[model samples]
Target: MLQIAVIGAGVFGKNHIRIYRELPGVHLAAVVDPAVTLEDTPVFASVDELLASGIPIDCASVCVPTVAHAQVASQLLRAGIDCLIEKPFAASLAEADQVLALAGQYGRIVQIGHLERFNPAVTATMPILTKPMFFESHRLSVFTPRSLDVDVVLDLMIHDLDIVLTMVNAPVTEVRAVGLPVLSPKVDIANVRLEFATGCVANFTASRVSTERVRKLRYFQPRQYVSLDFARQDLLVIDVADPAAAIAAFTQGAGLQHPSAGLSLRKLPVENGEPLKLEIESFLTSVQTRQEPRVTGQQGRAALELALEINQMIAQHAERAGLL
Candidate 1:
């Protein structure tokens, strides 16, 4: 059985621990957290403590604070442990570089925890990607002081940033952003627009001070318009460019109106599964096969670079508006 250790036991950390425990053929070795304890599983104050205890850990999930990601990941990697570091990769690009270098030196597999990439909606959207031209994304949540160490861009917007980057394989040519701090010292609400060399444009709005939670992304391409609901694991695709296949399906359904007015409407079939569980399973597959992870260190760094750029633009806008 593959032995896995969780490096944090906080909010998201607890979810990781629970998922690891539920999966078969994998042992939840221990949870490394000084502040919290898990029943039946040992808790180590740190990765060093766990290593010193000789628990035979094969891999670990670094779910610690953003600032501590590089440190914890470095230590584990140096000791020949593959790691799945939680989102944003690291607090800064330099730190992300260090984590990448350590993984390279140790020849260990590394997976960045961009959980939404594994979402069923995104999975279903992948096969239909032809030439995306425009995107509109919004991710909003009620105020919480959990990740105040970073701004809303890093806390919430990075998820969409990663998704957009994966979908649009073009170089970014322009960016415009605006953000405001409502509940904390850092930016809690942000709006960003990105233009790519391929003439694709994307608009993103993220907020941690919203009245309700929302996670949705909609995009339009040459002949298709797709909507994804991350919370509901739903994907809706509308195609008006091709009416032949649409009309046939509509006729076969006995005028059921599967397609309306030469428009093909489809709710794509998505294999529903918990994103975190799928992420962990993907990491384990890489570890066992000695292959590259779906979300490589390089892709994580690219996403982080874009997020930092958005933050810079937000700062500039904040300065112009006298919000700083």
Candidate 2:
């Protein structure tokens, strides 16, 4: 059985601990968190303590705070342990590079916890992608004290940014963004617009101060439109059967019963599963097979780079508005 440890006992880290215990062929070897203790597993106060214990750990989930990510992950990698790190890879690009370098040097697998990538809706939408040109994404959540070390861009919007970056596969040409602090000292709500080298445009809004929770993305391609609801694990696709017929229908003011008009709508089937569980399973698979993970360190760094850029834009906007 593969032995895994969870560093940090915070909200996300506890989930990782639970999932690791539930999954077969894996043992929840230990947990490293000074503030928390568990009955079932041994708890170490720090990474140093865990390493000193020599518990035969095969892998670990680095779910510590953003600032501590690099430090904790570096130690684990140096000790020859593969890691699955939580999102916002590191506090800065340099730290992210540090973790990446360590993982490369140790010949270990590293997967970033961009959990939405494992969502069934995203998985279902990938095969139908045919040059998406426009994207509209919204991710909102009620105020929470968790992950307050970073702004909404990194805490919430980075998930969508990662997904979009993966889909677009183009260089970002321009970035325009604005954000404000609502409940926390950092930006709690923000709007970002990105232009890509392939002429695609994307608009993203992320908020941690909303009254309701929402996680949705919609995109349009040449002859089709796709909608994804991350929370519901739902995917909807609408395809124009014939562009000429669609145009003619609009021009001729044809009724719904018009024989020449053609539009097909489908609700794609999604095999919904707990995203975290799937993410961990994928991470474990990569660790076992010595293969690259679904979300590699490089991809995580790319998302972090863009999120940092957007944060810079937000700072500039705030300064211009005299809010800083």
TM per model? 0.94, 0.97
Query: What are the C-alpha RMSDs, in order, of all predicted structures?
Result: 3.5, 1.5
Over 122-232, each residue of candidate 1 has an lDDT whose tens digit, in order, gives: 999999999999999999999986988889998899999999999998889999999888889899999999999999999999999999999999999887899999999
Per-candidate Cα lDDT values, in order, are 0.92, 0.95
lDDT of 1: 0.92
Model 2 quality (TM-score):
0.97
lDDT of 1 at 196: 97
In model 2, state the lDDT of residue 87.
97
Q: Write model 2 residue lDDT over 60-123, tens digit each, in one string.
A: 9999999999999999999999999999999999999999999999998899999999998999
